[model samples]
Target: MDHFLTFSLLSLLLSFAAAGDFSDDQLIRQVVPEEEQSVNLLNADHHFSLFKAKFGKSYSDEKEHDYRFSVFKANLLRAKRNQLLDPSAEHGVTQFSDLTPTEFKQRYLGLKTPAFLESAQKAPILPTNNLPEDFDWRDKGAVTGVKNQGSCGSCWSFSTTGALEGAHFLATGELISLSEQQLVDCDHECDQDGVCDAGCNGGLMNTAFQYTVKAGGLQLEKDYPYTGRDGKCQFDKNKIAASVANYSVVSVDEDQIAANLVKNGPLAVGINAAWMQTYVKGVSCPYICSKNRLDHGVLLVGYGAAGYAPIRFKEKPYWIIKNSWGESWGEDGYYKICRGQTHDICGVDSMVSTVAAFQSTSE
Candidate 1:
C-alpha cells in the first residue's frame, strides 16, 4: 500500500511538471532549490524594506504594515515563479507589489472590449519591402514623453490619444501631448455588447476614436488636463487641438502591423497585462500568456531587435509598447513583448488599430 501511494504521488508530480501548472504559487515554489529558497526567504524582508523606500510606500499603522509585509512576501514568491516561467525577462517587486492581483487589475487596467470590432475602417495594405530592422517614432520627433494615468482605469483613453498624437505629429510636425481627460469626461459611446465607455470604469479605443470623429476633435492637455478621476465633461469645441479624419483596424499580420506603424503612426492595441504587475525590465515573453484575455490598452510606438541577427525573425525582434503607468514602471513606461513565428504573444497583434487620417492645430 505504501508502494502504491508512492507511485501515485510520483505520477502526479510528473503530470504537474509536464503541464506547467501555475494554479498555485506554492506548487511553483517547489521549483526553487531548497538552498536558494532559504536565501530568498532570508532576503525577502530586506527586499521589502528597499521596495518601500524606493516606491515611497508606507502603512498608516502597525496592523496595516504587518498585512502589507505578508502581501509583499507573497509577491516575492510570485516574482520567483514568474522569473522561472519567463527566463529571458526580469520580474521582481514593483510599485504594485503591495496590491492584490484583483485590486491591481481593477485599479490599473481598464480596457472593455466591444462585442463586434466592425466599427473602424480597415487600413490599406502598405508595402512591407525594405522595412527597417529597428524603427522608433520617438527618434523621428513624434512620440511624447511618458505620462501616468494615475489610479484611474482610463488606460483606454491614453491609448486612443497616443495614437492620435502620433498621427497629428506626422501631419503638422508638432508632437503635442493630447488630453486623456477629454475622453474620460465627455465621450461615452457604447457598442453592441452594451459595454460603454464609463470614464474611469473602462472603455475601448475604437469607440473612443468614433467619439473623437463625432465630437469634432479633442482639446489640449493644458486646457483639459487629467485629474485621474471621473468628472463632468468640459470639452471646448472651439479649442480643438487635433481631429481624427478616420481610424482603421490593422491586419493580424505582424509585418503589416510593422508597416502601419512605420507609415501611419503609433498603433493602439490591447494586451492581457497579467504578468505586467511584477514585470520590471527585459523583454516580457511569458511561457503561458493568454492571447484573447486582453485587459489593458497601450500604444505601439516602435519595434526593435535584440541579440543575434543572422537568425532573425521571431528569435530577435520585439514590439515596443508605450504604457500609461508612468515613467517609474517597466522600461520607463514602456514594454517589449517578443514576436512569435505565428499569430501573437498576448493579443498585442490581435486587436490592433491605427489612425488612418487626421489634422492637428498648432500651439
Candidate 2:
C-alpha cells in the first residue's frame, strides 16, 4: 500500500510536469519572476490544474495546450500589472485565470451595442424625490441569478431578460428567471414600428422591449431555457408568462438614471465592456476603460463604494453591474464601474432603459 501510494503521487507529479512545455519551475519563473523558487512549482501546479479544468479535454491536445499556456502567461502579466499599477483599487480583476484572452473576448465580450436610437413613443417624465444615496434591486427581491450566455454573442437577449425579470418580480412579488433563448430566436424580426434586435449578432434593449410588447408576453426560463446558440423561433404563445405594458429609455443624465432605478427596478444598459475581459476586481474607470465606446449590454443592479488601504480612488463610488458570463467571471458574475461621474465611465449613462410590467392579478 505504501509503494502504491508513492507510485500514485509520482504519477500525479509527472502528469502535472508533463501538462506544459516548460518545467514547473521554469513556467512559474516566466510569469512571476519575483518568487522564482518559492512559487515555481506550487504556482505551476495550481495554474495547470485550473487551466485543465477550464479547457477540459483541450488541455491534453499539444497545440491547444501550448496556445492556452501562452494565454495563461499573458493573463498572469495582466494580473500583476493590475496589482502594481492600482493595488489600492477596490474592485480587483482576477476571475479570468482559467480562460485565455481570446476565449474570454469571444465568449463574454462580444456584445455589439449600437448607439441608442430615439424611441417614438413619448414617455412621461418620472418624478424624482428623496432618492437614496445607494440602492440595489437585489435587496428588494427583484434581481435574478447570475447567468451564463455560453459562446453566443447574445448579451442583448440576456440584458433584456434581466430587465424583464426585475420588472416582473417587482410587479408580481415573485422573482423568477426568464428566457434569453426566447429572445435570441424570436426577437430578431422587426417590430410593428420597424425596430428590431439583431439576435445573436447584436441588439438593443428598446427593440427587445418592442418585440416583447408585440409578442404579448415572454416565457419563463424553465419553459424555454437558454441554449446559447441561435435557432429557429419556437415561441409558443400559450407559454407566455410575463409581459410589459411599455418601456422607456432614461435620459443620459446620471441623476435621472438613478431616480429611475429607485422608482423602477433594474435597468438594461450598454457600455464599453472591452477592458472588462481581464478585470478580476477594481473600480473600472476612464483610466482603463472608455467612456464613449458602448459595445456590451448589461443589467445595472445597484451602486456602492469599493475601497481598500493605500487609497487609489478613496471610497471610490461605483455602479454594481450584473453580467451574464456565469458567476465564475467577475465579483461573482458582477462588475463595478467607477460611478458618480457626470458623463459616466464606460457609457453607463448612454443607453439605460426600464420596462414596466403589468401588475399580475395575484399581486
Candidate 3:
C-alpha cells in the first residue's frame, strides 16, 4: 500500500509537468496559419531561442503557477503569430535584436538619463506630501488591463484612458473601467488613425486628458470595446460620464513618499521599462529586459521602505499600476517597479489627482 501511494504521487507530479508542456514547433503551429507556417518557422525558432535564453532557466517548479504557464504559452503564441503576419516587421527582433549586446545592457538595465535631473531643472519646487495611510483610492476597484497596441504605437491612448479611469473613480467614488477603444475611435483632435499620429512612436498623457475633458468625458468599456487599429469615431452618449478633471504629475522623495502614503492614494508616473529585468519577487537589479527605448507608461500607487530596499506597491509600497497589456499580464493586470532607486524612474515621487478634499485644496 505504501509503495502504491508513492507511485501515485510521482504520477501526479509527472502529469502536472506534462500538462503544462509545450515546444517551439508546437507553439508555431498553433499561432501561425498553415499557409505561412513554413516561411515563418525560422523566425519562430529565432524568437523562441531568444525567449529561452532570457527566461528559460528562470521558471522552476517552485515558481510554476498556472498563470505563469498561461502567460508563457500566450506570449510564445503571440510571437509566432506576429512573425507569420508581419515577417518583415523589424521592430520585435531586429529593432531590439540589432542592438549590440552591450548597447542592450546599457539601454535596459543601466540608467543613462540622470534621475530627477530633468524634472528638477524645470518644475517649481513643491512641498513633499505623503499619501494617506487609509487612502481608499487604490481600492477604488479592479481595472481591466489592455493589450500592447503592438506596432500600432498607441501607448498615449492607453496611458490616457488608464489614468482617466482611476481619476474618474477617485472623483465620483465609483469605479468604472473605461474604454480605450472609445478614445481611439472618437479622438480626432490628434492626428490620423486616432493613435495621435502613426509614427508608431509615443505620446503624452496630458494631451489625452485634455481631449477627454473637452469631449465631456468618455464611455465605459462595455459600450465601446477595443477593436484593435483605429476605426471611425463613434460616441455612445449613454455610456459617457459627466466630467473628468485634468490629470496632474507629482514628484516626491523617500520621506515625502512615506508622508504621502498617509495623505493620498495611487499616483501615475512614467516608468523607464528599459531596466525591467525578471519581475520575480525578491530579485534585485541586473535587469535583462530590452533596452531599445522606454516606450511604455504605467501608474504608481504607493511606496514602502520595508524590504532590504524600498519597493513601490501599486497596492502597497508597490504602487498598484495599471498596464495597457490586458489582464493576463503581470501581477493580475499591472506591474510593479522597484522604488528607492532614488532615480524616481518608477515615478515614486510622481503624483496623480485624488477625490480627497486635500488634493482639491492643493490644486
List TM-score per model, in order. 0.88, 0.78, 0.52
Report the C-alpha lDDT of model 3 over 217-314, residue by residue, as the tens digit: 77776777776566777886655753554444343554454443334434335454432222323322211121223444555444444333322232
lDDT of 2 by residue, 209-245 (tens): 8788889878888888888877888898887888988
Q: What are the root-mean-square deviations of the candidates from the true structure over C-alphas? A: 5.5, 12.0, 15.8
Rank order by TM-score, top first? 1, 2, 3
Per-residue lDDT of candidate 1, residues 1-363 (tens digit)? 134533553465456657764433334455444443432668777888999999999999999998988888878777876775555578888999998778898999999975235656788898999899999998898899999998999999999999999999888888888899999999898876778898899999999998998998999999999999999999988889999988889988999999999999999999989879989987776655667678899999999866232212225568999999999999998988888453598778888998854665434
TM-score of 3: 0.52
lDDT of 2 at 100: 63
Top of the candidates by lDDT = 1
| Maximum-TM-score candidate | 1
Supply the global lDDT for candidate 1. Answer: 0.82
Give the runs in model 2 whose Cα sits over 4 Å from its true position. 1-46, 54-57, 82-103, 120-129, 190-196, 305-309, 360-363
Rank list by lDDT: 1, 2, 3
When 2 and 3 are scored with TM-score, the better candidate is 2
**Model 3 stretches astray by more than 4 angstroms:** 1-151, 188-201, 252-265, 277-294, 307-320, 346-363
